[model samples]
Target: MLTVQDHELVAAAIGEAETRTDGEISVVVAPESDSYADAVLHWALLVALLPLALFATFPDLLHWATAFVHEPWGDEAPPLRLIVLFLLFKTISAFLVAWAIFRLPRVRIAITPHETRTRRCRRRAIMVFQVGTERRTATRSGVLLYLSMAERHAEIVADELIQSKIGGEEWGEAMAALLAGIRAGQPGQGIADAVRLIGDVLATHFPYTGTDPNEMPDRLIQL
Candidate 1:
């Protein structure tokens, strides 16, 4: 059993580890520590902001080399209008991108055969995600999950948000299946096949293939 004391609850929606459900077990793929906000912010700047900056500047910046035919703003007044409009458009675009990314839901990214249910703890009615096989409503507050454990140092796994209403026997059976692959003897069905199977399960819950809702399971899934 994943105990709160054992694993550091980096972030949770309610009472630490207060959620569970049948067929649902939370497995931590990676926690907030590994995936800090800084990374996302940096990526946004690189992918969104920089291109928009160039777009905004490109209009007036052509003075050094004249290539464009029609200046959208027209030069009748002054270059200032074009620069200002460019900046305004870029600013709006960047703002929208930031808002969209911030408001988007988060889901588990790695392996372990379990599901997660998280809600933004304080704003329980707000953003939520059911990181599981089939989509279902979960706690509606922002959440990042992990399976917390302790041996010598605290070990936090990435999918703590799995909500399972498991019968005791089923839970036990599932755990046995998980451990069976790791046990030393004969290494059940070979390690590679076992790992591949686990990866397949994670893909079902939270696909890492692409963020597009239109994307179906990839035929040639490299991951």
Candidate 2:
């Protein structure tokens, strides 16, 4: 678990900015981040390492391939170094791992006032596959965004944070409407949009999301 404070990077960046400003300083703070652990590991790296581990643990496998290297220019063949083999395996594994991840069609979304970036992470069905055969599936990264104090700019960050554990798309759309409302100075509609989206999605089959603030079964809302 690599725990990083949201203020940690901001502080350092601000210090650098201030020093360069030559006594005039403006501090900037982006969104803060929370601690998270992940398991979407580099399996291809392991696949590459596995061979070298096996080689180190079993060197005789080299002999079979070395048989082809009996040319008179034997110095060119080198000593068939173990490190060379390890590095070769490492390099090949990197490409293969990237390729594998690229094929998995999953959706991930991150939104900010700036722009949104998405990626696909799961295999899609036939219809879905056609729409994203070239790699455009959306997946939930199980992420949540947290609000933080900004320094000078309305700074927002997407990486390195775990957001509120809510079903994002439904909630996110509602929230987008909410923010857009705020930007457009229609706070009432923003609130209403949020209420409607949250309420309807919750009341219906959107099982992943919670009930809307206004539609919370009265008793639940009261509580």
Candidate 3:
């Protein structure tokens, strides 16, 4: 969701922020934490199954409707095969309709709860940190700032060295600051601000060690 200028702005901010600290900060923004297809499919499946119960409970309506249409059914109840076929068709139709409707990102996001969104965001952030940022530096003071635009969620993950020095609650205000910018439709600015704020925090605990090497990238990662 960020433009080229925004990327440059954030990259510059990161470069500046890391200058006075031995800690490393990596930022990543994702379009979404997850596709949430499973949740949509679950909802769709439930909706699709509801019609089967309704049709089974009201078979007379079906029989009468079929007779009214002059269908070539025998003078007995609708056959089991017919009922199964009808329900199957209805279920398949319902599934297709639901899938089509829920394919919209907004609709999928709406069906996902805030708690789930937060959990998934955090999980993905941790995964990114583990795979990309954790222990990459000599001092192991790496930190990750992960943002999921679809969920409007932010997660900060710090390596063991940094985590041992700073409590998790201390990052709440940074997250809040980032989220405020995001809510204002200025995610790039929000990320830059968060980088600065986090840099300030890291600087406080791990002030510049003169010969410290730049061990990590300073560019914003978008996915």
Candidate with top TM-score is 3
Answer with 2 or 3, whichever has the higher lDDT: 3
Worst 10 residues of 3 by lDDT: 65-74
Question: Residue 32 of model 2: what lDDT?
Answer: 25
For residue 31, model 3's alpha carbon misses the true position, in angstroms, by 1.0
Order of candidates by lDDT, top first? 3, 2, 1
Candidate 1, residues 1-223, lDDT tens digits: the string is: 3234223322221122222211122233222222224435544455456645565578456442222322643567455555455556666677568645743334221211122122112121121123332233232111222222111011112223332321223233333443453353322222223233333343344334332232112111110
Report every candidate's CA lDDT.
0.31, 0.32, 0.87
lDDT accuracy of residue 197 in candidate 2: 47
TM-score of each: 0.27, 0.27, 0.91
List residue ranges in candidate 1 displaced over 4 A.
1-36, 52-76, 107-223
Candidate 2 vs candidate 3: the TM-score winner is 3
